[model samples]
Target: MNLDREVIKALAPTGVLRASINLGNPILANTSKSTGEPEGVSIDLARAFAQHLGVDVELVVFDAAGRSVQAVASEQADIGFFAIDPVRGAEIAFSAAYVLIEGSYLVREESPLLHNDEVDRDGCLVAVGKGSAYDLFLTRELKHAHIVRAPTSPTVVQTFLEQELDVAAGVKQQLESDCRKHAGLRLLPGRFMVIRQAMGVPKTRGAGAARALHAFVEEMKDSGSVADALQRHSIEGASVAPNEA
Candidate 1:
């Protein structure tokens, strides 16, 4: 496929395509047990995008979603995989979502909370990853319940358990994996939100770069590349998003 030089230059201004990879979201990315390299759907997509541009891909890894977003927003990285949110949109130009992941709350089995709504009442303390999609959304939407921020999305459960917080909020799969390890932790029935996972570049990258990324996202989704990547990584509890509506 012929590529646009200006778009490629805008996206890979430093001579190589630098993609921010967040390992906090297990369904999107994780460390390879053997090679210790980042691997997951997001990494796969990033490599594919850089390959399409005829550029070598470099993974700028972060253990938290906020750090990853900040990397892209600060122009430290060329692109990033992120959950699309209004708060992050100020500095990031996000493509239409290529995948959808469920955001859920986890509570101790003995806890009284059974529904997502019940966690919002007074005296309830929810643990969330600092600057995560759940934290940003809850900060804007929640009126009563208090929020306790963990250092990263992957540590929400540990924070919740250690602090005895009322609930843990994060990716459903992460919570599920934590529940299996810790026991006595149960996810609230259903999901509180559908996270729109997408590729993004700094808004300063220009409209051409943004449109190119957006079109690439739509193509990845429509062509089943995103779905195939999920399957190849054995990722469950997430689905490829439909074309931008």
Candidate 2:
């Protein structure tokens, strides 16, 4: 469990651990309703990781997943929590997932779409957060459905309603909350995809740094820190990822 000096230096070159926090993913990170400051599972993990490195933590916040990914890939951030995708893998070294979330589809209750499969029809239009994991996954999997991109995951439902799109795609928890807030909206029977949420470091950080961060994440998962964060944050519709070891 020794923290390597070189790894720490690489991870926090500025003597501060800059964590790329995406507030768009409410289950993982979000603005505190009362304080207006950032707080959530990701923030908890960022603080923990920073403490392990004996460095101060700095949050580089973003409103969308794409911008978060960009921050880490471009070395603007030391580490970040991200949904694993091969597209993002090129510029980032990803640890085994510490959590998993469901990517779901939402439609008007009166809409004819009853199942996840039914949303891929030729005339179907799906509203998705631009550069989100759901957007990336669906872009590859769906052939006939046209994707209408929204500015962020939180806006997907609003965009869908305004544009009169056929379906909205996002995290199951987010969709569920939206369904309750707006009413007359329903989630499909099952999930469209399972998002593997993991810790990531810029690949340019070197193999030693990547391995160190990966081991840290694995230890956090095995130690139940990830589960505790989810519970502490009252995050539902998501689960801790299984320990890889």
Superposition error at 59 for model 1 (Å): 0.4
Candidate 2 structure quality by residue, lDDT tens digits, 83-112: 999999999999889999999999998998
Across 1-245, the per-residue lDDT of candidate 1 in tens digits comes to 46689889999998899999999999999999999889999999999999889999999999999999999999999999999999999999999999899999999999988899898898889999999999999999789999999999999999999998999999999999999999788999999999999999999989999999998888888888999999999999898888884
| Global fold similarity of model 1 (TM-score) | 0.98
lDDT agreement of model 1 with the native: 0.93
Q: How many backbone clashes does candidate 2 have?
A: 0
Query: Can you list the residue pairs that collide in candidate 2?
Result: none
Write down the TM-score of every candidate: 0.98, 0.98
Instruction: State the C-alpha lDDT per candidate.
Output: 0.93, 0.93
The reply for model 1, stretches above 4 Å from the true place, is none
Model 2 regions more than 4 Å off: none
